[model samples]
Target: MSKYFAVLLLLIFSTQIQALEKVTLQLKWTHQFQFAGYYMAKEKGFYQEEGLDVIIVPADPNNPNVDFRVLYGQAQFGVFHSGLLKQRLEGKPFVALAALLQSSPYCWMVKAQSGIYVPRDFQGKRISLLGHTENGELLMMLQRAGVNTDSMLLYSGKKPFDDFIAGKFDAMQVYSTNEPYQAQQLGVATREICPKQFGLNVYADVLFTTEAMLRDRPQQVMRFRRASLKGWRYAMLHLEESLAVTKANYATHKSLAQLAYEAEKLKDFIRVSGIPIGKMSAAKWLWIAQLYHLDVSQFHEHKADFIYSEVKQDPASLSWVLIIAAVLTLVCIPMYIQLIFSRKNKSHLR
Candidate 1:
């Protein structure tokens, strides 16, 4: 009886040990090099090795608010712009798990020969602006730089790349990665005016999760974070492999050379940030909150203590621990019941 009971316990424990955890990750944007780390992690089996089944969902531009909606409860984790996350943290119960890009990738681009020397040059000139939080940041930047944002004619539209190339606007707020690379590919002479150059340093991409998840499933969060950080480290070290993974995910840009360029550019941006990957500083958070005029007090109240500064354990080893613990728990349960029954019988005999 004891041998059968032990075998039964072992089988149950083994089944529990092999149980897979499912996690869905929401990307901030469509498939691009910006999210190459996650793709690399999936491709390299980092998540699987960590005992996680991760689904990476690319965000739809048409549904701009989809990330927040999914993150509120629908998804276990979400990739988002730190600025957007900062604003949402004011009222929403969300906490940033890690900072992906240490620096903002936003910049103003102009024709190389335009000789537009300074922000003052943008005054009274036509400028392309994307309507959203970026527009607000640009407005603030221009105000600080003594540029009359209202004096300039604003071309509010999507994919301002074509319009800028057609000489529709003197300059446009373009992603330092995509638009600039696309322009160079077309042989368009352009120069990037980094927002950081104009004192508009903001944190860009971040990994975030709801406060509820952080509290209820902290180990899961740690596992995901460790796996993601490992993926990023691998991507940075194995650049060519990461690019191949990116190409596989975004099939439209079928050119390997283009994919390589995109990957190299992302690597450069990451290097220039000076901060190591996955490190989010308190000062950066404070600056973002101040820039957005959000009430930081609200965030402090709910999530001040829950933010994970670093991974507490090796993600790769957590699964084994869970498996062992589950096995021990299963084995001990029946033994405890039997011991209780034997004790009761002895008492009755007495």
Candidate 2:
């Protein structure tokens, strides 16, 4: 009977230990090559190795307020712009865990033969922009190039790339990773002008979580970060495997050439020194704060630390710090009880 009871207890404890830690990650956009690293991680069992079961939720265009949704605890983590994070962290508390892209991929592209060699050519031209943010960035870039945005006609909508190829717009703001590669695969030669060339360097695709999660479940966050960084490093190193994983996820957009081009571009973007993969710096945070016109003083007051520099450290340190502290307490607890009992006996004798 004693042997059976012991075996039953061990089984119960083993079952409890194998129960996976649940985490939810919200992507900034729909499934595409941009998020190939995360997909590769899931497909390759990296998250499982870290004892995590990660669920990736796609962002809804209709309900675009992922920041508030994440803040209210609808999700555990999210991928978004540092600008949006700066704005969201004003009153609400959130921490940036890692930056996927070292630099913004925002760029204006035109057909190579369109005679639109420079931004000045954009004056008196029609341009297609996806949203107001892209339009604003393009306008800023144009202004720097001495091209007045008022002089150009703006067409804003989500439409086919063929629209630009058919002379609908003289230029368009497309991701340096996506549309440009798609155009190249279609034999549509394009000239891309990165917005950063004009001194507009915004941080793109930042990973973040709520303050509550950080405080209450630091171990879970650490595990997730380590797994994600491993996934990112693998994706960066194994380009073909990463693209294969992405293609499996987004089978509708089939163009091996385009995927290859995007993978190469993204690799370059992620390799920049200032933008270490899965890390964030205080200087970058301050720069983002300034860009969004946020008060830096407020951040200094409630300052939440989210950057994980030790995310890639050895697995032993990944163990729960609180667990170690508890063990130390348990060891000292017996000595404390003995001291109390000894004092009580001496007082009774007196």
Candidate 1 per-residue lDDT, tens place, 212-285, comes to 88778777888888889889888899988787778876535547776676677667656555677878777667
Top model number, lDDT: 1
Model 2 whole-model lDDT (C-alpha atoms): 0.72
Q: Give candidate 2 misplaced runs (Cα > 4 Å).
A: 1-17, 61-65, 118-121, 130-136, 157-160, 249-255, 296-350
The segments of candidate 1 whose C-alpha lies over 4 angstroms from its true place after superposition are 1-18, 157-159, 250-254, 272-274, 296-307, 310-350
- The Cα RMSD in angstroms, rounded to one decimal, for candidate 1 relative to the true structure is 7.3
Q: What are the clashing pairs of model 2?
A: none
| Residue 259 C-alpha lDDT in model 2 | 74
| Candidate 1 lDDT score at position 220 | 81
The TM-score measured for candidate 1 stands at: 0.81
Worst 10 residues of 1 by lDDT: 298-307
